[model samples]
Target chain A: MKNRVVITGMGAVTPLGNSVAETWEGICRGKSGIGRLTKFDCTAHETRIAGELKDFDPLRFVNKKELRRLDDFIIYALAAAEMALADAGLASGAAEGERTGVIIGSAIGGLATIEKEKEAIFLGGPRKMSAFTIPAVLANLASGHVSIRFGAKGPIGCSVTACSSGACAIGDAVRLIAEGHADCMIAGGVEAAVTPLCVAGFNAMRALSKRNEEPEKASRPFDRDRDGFVIGEGCGIVILEALPRALDRGTRICGEIAGYGNTSDAFHMAAPPPGHEGAVRCMQAALRDAGMEAAGIDYINAHGTSTPLNDAYETEAIKTVFGEHTRRLAVSSTKSMTGHLLGAAGGIETIFCMKAIDTGMLPPTINLDHPDPTCDLDYVPHQARKAAIRTAMSNTFGFGGVNAVLIVKKFEE
Target chain B: MTLEEKVISIIMEQLDVTREECVAEASFIDDLGADSLDLVELIMEMEETFDVQIADNELEKIRTIKDVFEFLKSRGTVWQE
Candidate 1:
């Protein structure tokens, strides 16, 4: 029999705040973490704003020597993993547990490291570059470094599925534990692509929001005025344990990772198929996997990246899947406040869904001043609402037309 | 700073160690907790600071704090102590 997988703990380092508590607080207030890009000069770039973390200290996760040796993506991944382990009450002994594992998802592994090292090599010789360049820039190093630090001996991996990377990583972890390959897994997604080169490249593609005048109001998901998605950086991780074992050990069960669905819209490389056919099939599959119906889900944390295409398409997809229940489902795009975390979007959005179920409150899609007429739905706009959300689903789609959906429900004995 | 002091200071900064760990007989690997990469970085830093490159073959010969001092002294670089 396949084991039941439950979430024991969660940790996050997001643009809104450093810890789960801080980030959740920001979300509940419909606060906007988006702001002007401060990582580099964006004079030449069309997009001048991004969602950079406030007052993040890598020292909390790694030593000084190690920090210089690692990249920002790895640091954020490690920080979130450490926090998750601590919350799960498995921090110190994780290294000794042969059954423990680590998985991290990232779209672009270490863009900052790559950008800086490229400049170094161009100015000096290849040998003049820092010895840590290779390890820092490799996308898999996010998982590799975490496994090394926590000494996880079981399965280890990194998911590079474009923007849906984190969701894919968590989905893989759920499968591993459910199939009895591992007892526990520290898994999540991270990104530090707020670099100059990435910004320029994304700008060249016209994929970023250029609303530099008011950064906070720029990410208006499902609203008619959303120009584009605000690029953001952050990490989110959760501790998943086999249900029987967690109950045996008397752990605080956050929720059950009831279902996950992954699908590829082979129709396009960067855009979804007309009417989001892949997304519709993916959501239907996730509900089936959960042994539940669309009516069972009380809320949905929409992908709602604030991009004109994504928000509109995602809303249409939701309508197609939920049909008559569309009116009852309290839907909101926490991305409206957190911005588009890309690969890390799934991780944080899943956490938001869990919080919604546990706390009985729904996070709002801020800046929804004027709802797009075609994208008709109750988006719980501008401010959070009090509600009894027993089950919530999170949706994340990536640049490769990859769609991933996860369902979390309140723990029931 | 003396040659010994200047070199030790670089070791302290490069290896992230304390002054006490920079004693004459302390091994870069065992005593100071340095790995292969750390040692390489230390050597690179010293080369940049001292303006003299150590031969690749000589890297194996220097394992302790004193070996670095003597190697630079052998280079006859103008410095004190």
Candidate 2:
């Protein structure tokens, strides 16, 4: 049998807040982080509103010089990892060197840096570009920087699967610990693609919310008036440790990572299949890995991106997987509050689900007015609920038809 | 303080420490808490803020804030105090 892995520390540099407690408070208060774009002028873009990190002074976490060399994505990851390390109380003591690993993923890394350098090259000569271009904007630098910062000597790597990158990273980290490759792993997702180019690309595809007027109510997942996702920036990180090691060190076990499953649709590049067969399979695979029945799960953090097609297909996928139990499951889309964090969605949502189980408080899927006729599940709309949640599943399906489901349960002694 | 000293102050500020914490005898990663990427970013920020182009070899020679300030000062870029 594989070893059990439990989450001991959690941190977030989300649009909701800079840390887990801050983000949770913001989420519980139903605060919306979406607002007008301040990074660039979005006069020409269809989707002007984005879930930008407001007043995020990077110097709080990283040095100014270091900030320029690394992309915003890496900054977010490192900051969140520092918070997680500190929270775990393992930042300075044992497990400081080896036996610790990092797997931080980003869907699109160093996008803003690339965009700026590309503009410089276009406007001036090649000599105008600085030498820090390549290392500043790569996908793996987030993990690379995290390892260097924290001195985590175990297997450190980054995964890039668009939206599923964060989930894949965490899932892979859990497997690594279970297989005895490492005793502890820092895993999560970070994305800093709140640039003009990203906004334009998604806007051109109509994959974003054009509700520039009402930014707060812009992301209405599962609602009949649902439009599209609001692009957000930040990172979410969790420290996973072997159960025995956690107990030995007296670490607080927030939740046990029961199962993780991932699959690719190979059918579409941007859209989920009609019936969400891939999503259904993904969730089922997780359940099988977890060795739990469908009726065992109490809450589900939906991949409800507020888009018309995604919300419909996710509803279908849940029903297809849970069947009659779908009616009994308490499902909600925290994306309704934090917006779609892209690669960071899976990690942040996983943290939310685990916290929900730990606290027995189900986060609400705010703005679920006039639910779509096709979705017939208890969405836990508008307000939080109290329930004894033993198992919770967090689902994330990315742009490349990549689907991932992670099952987490409250730790019992 | 000389122009070099003024430039060193900015480098120290960018590196996130005090003058005593980052000295001429210190190495970016070995002595300071900086990583490889942090050093690279420090070079870029120095170039941008000082208006002096730092070549690869010159950047490699910079181990501390003092080295950065001196290097920029030697390149005829006057630092403001």
Candidate 3:
């Protein structure tokens, strides 16, 4: 048997809130964080709304000098990591440095910084470039900065599998701990790509909702009126430690990471296969790895990105996996309230699964007044429901046909 | 503001230090806790603020506030005497 890994702490900086407690409260309340795009000028784009962070001042988390040298994504990652470490009560300096690692992923790193530097070069020639541009824009810097801040000297890396980046990172952290590479791992994802170029790119692909008048009602996953996803920016982090070590240290264990499955569709870059074969296989693999039957899963925090194709395909995948039990399962898409956080989706959604397991309250998929005929499963729509949840699964599919699924359950000796 | 005062303010802001810490004898790395990245950004800020170009070799010579002020003086940047 492999070493069991359990989640000891979690942190988040989402469009809904700046901490895990606040974000969970917002989720339970079914509050929508989507609003008009304020990061950049979206006058020419077809979609002008995004789930941008409100009142998040980086100075609260980082010093002014360090803030200027790091990108917004890195800042978000650092803040979330700090919170996670503090919650775990394991200061990086106090932990065995060689046995602690960090894996923070980002789909698009330093995009805002790149935009600024590119504009400077175009407007004022090459001499106008900033010296810290290179370090500020690299994707791995998110992990680098966190490791440096916490003094964690173990295996550190960043997973860049588009939207599945966070799930992949967390999954990889489990492998590292199982392999004895690290006893503790700080893993998560962060993204701050709500810039003009990102907006234009998604708008050009017609992958964004153009509901300018009603931003909150725009991201309606599984609903018949759903069009596309609303872009969001944030970070979510969790501290995973070996079960034995956690018990020895008397650390609080939120949940146990039972299994992780990752696969590639190899069909389309931006779209899933006709029947979501990859997603179905991913979930099955995770279930098999966890040594559990499909009927054992109590709730599912779906990848429902509020996009039409993703929602229908994910629903079909769920039905194919669970069959008759699909009707009994209470599946919800927190994205309905938080929007699609891209790479951070898997990380934040995983935390939501933990929350459900802890609280026995199933979060709702708000704005599902008229469900799509193809999506027939119970989505726990409109309002939160009270239910006993012991095991939960989170699914995340990225743009590059990458599918990742994780199964977490209530920890018991 | 005079050149010295302007330099002090920029150093204070870029290094996140106080005015007292920006003394002439204070070394950026030793006294002000600046890493390589901080030094590079400080140079860039100075160049933009003074509208003067600093060569790669000249960056090596700048170790202290006095060194930066002297380098600016050599580059024909005038200050209130």
- Share of reference contacts found in each model: 0.42, 0.33, 0.75
State the lDDT of candidate 1 residue by residue for A1-413, as single tens digits: 88889999898999999999999999999999998899988787788889999899899888878888899999998898888888888777744477888888999999999889899889977767887888899999988988888888899999999889999999889999999999888888999999998888877777888899999998999999988889999999999999988998798999999999999898888888889999999898889888999989899999898888988888889999999999998999998888888889988999999989889899998999999998889999898999987899999898888999999989997
Per-candidate DockQ versus the true complex?
A: 0.64, 0.30, 0.74
lDDT of 1: 0.89
For residues A56-162, write the lDDT of model 3, one tens digit per residue. 88998899887877899999998998888888987656644889999988899999999999999999899778888999999989999998888889999999999
Which candidate do you rate higher for DockQ, 2 or 3?
3
DockQ of 2: 0.30
> Among the candidates, what TM-score does chain A have in each?
0.98, 0.98, 0.99
Candidate 3 — which pairs collide?
none
Per-model TM against the reference: 0.97, 0.90, 0.98
- For model 2, what is the alpha-carbon lDDT of residue A293? 93
* Clash count of each predicted structure: 0, 0, 0
lDDT of 2 by residue, A256-357 (tens): 999999999989999998799899999999999899999999999999999999889999989989988988999999888888999999889999998888
Q: CA shift at A277, candidate 2, in angstroms? A: 0.4
Docking class of 3: medium
lDDT of 3: 0.92
Superposed Cα deviation of residue A355, candidate 1 (Å): 0.6
CA error at residue A235 for candidate 2, angstroms: 0.9
TM-score of chain B of 1: 0.93
